[model samples]
Target: MTVTTQPDYRCTPSPLHAILLAGTVPLFLGALLSDIAYYNSFQIQWTNFAAWLIAGGLLFAGLALLFALANLIRADRKAGRPVMYLVLLLVTWVLGLVNAFEHAKDAWAVMPSGLVLSVIVSVLAVITAWLGLSNLRSGGAR
Candidate 1:
């Protein structure tokens, strides 16, 4: 009798992706606060720069996450859930980016809208990250 072992086809979630997702909320909050400060004080401070940096980082991270998810889906056709999560993440990221740009331009009128977008982005990022991490821990899709 001969016995054969099957290879595990499970794909592991990238730690960088998790980090990005986890950091999104805090970073957006920091940006929002900094934007508020800048507007209230009417002065350019370190917080302004920090907000821009965080927003730029998030934009890049969002793109990276989308790419990673796309690759995973391509490799495992069964992994469909993550696609929705990624899409939601990307949409929110774009909204956040728009807010970030408005803030950078010192358009205080847009701050309220940006704040709302940032909150939405944070929620979506958290959900997406949780789903990705959970799927990876559970050995991925069926």
Candidate 2:
């Protein structure tokens, strides 16, 4: 008798994951643009809008990262440790939260560093999410 084993394929990502991955970059950019507008024009209202935009994007991106981490853990128990991704996401989330708070309070002095941090985090998140999504789609089977 002969036995054959087939490789297990990962499942496609959910709509929420897709949305989070798709929206994160644009949302981050929009927030950045709003910040620029506010800073250049000294418009308090624009800063408030930017703060909320960043907050909302951070929420969605954070959720997406959590979902990706869970899926990675389930798909490959031995080789699915995404520690860097997790750390970066966490840092991004924290920085974004602080930035949002500062923007809300019109603390322009400290907003630039937060904005830069947000951009860095957003880029890293996009890369990580793309890789995770690709792995899911490709079945990441050994």
Candidate 3:
């Protein structure tokens, strides 16, 4: 007698896909920093093009994040507000950093508490964003 084994496949969508995709804060930051690096590396003017690239990336990323959250929240999704709130907090922290960078040497270190707070805020934002997106994507579909 011969025995054969069957393979099992999952029909449900992956929640982690949405989680990982939505959690692209680092990618966005990379784009922002790359814009700066482009200027420095090429001896280009900051006001000419690099700033625009960074600004555009930031705008698109922020809008995409907002829209994704809106879709999930409108679908009666759970555990989304905390993430959105933290994203906003991150924005505020970034704005502060920009202003501080205008004059402070070692701007990120100007306030030790702020540096710590920024990291905490960013980590919370990413984790919450992932959790929220994960909850949105794992449908009950077959």
Candidate with maximal TM-score: 2
lDDT per residue, candidate 1, 55-104, as tens digits? 66476557657766665566645445555656666776776667666556
> Candidate 2's residue-wise lDDT over 23-48, tens digit each?
76677667887877866787677777
- For every candidate structure, what is the RMSD over all alpha carbons to the true structure, in angstroms? 4.7, 3.8, 9.7
Better of 1 and 2 by TM-score: 2
Q: Residue 117, candidate 2: how far off, in angstroms? A: 2.8
TM-scores of the models, in the given order? 0.64, 0.70, 0.36
Cα displacement (Å) at residue 32, model 3: 4.8
Error of 3 at 100 (Å): 12
Positional deviation of 130 in candidate 2, in angstroms?
2.8
TM-score of 1: 0.64
Model 3 C-alpha lDDT per residue in residues 25-136, reported as the tens digit of each score = 5643443344345434643332233233334434544555555555545443343443454465356346534523421333223333433333443454455445444333
**Model 1 alpha-carbon miss at residue 129, Å:** 2.0
- Which regions in candidate 2 have their CA more than 4 angstroms from the true location? 1-12, 80-87, 136-142
Candidate structures ordered by TM-score, highest first:
2, 1, 3
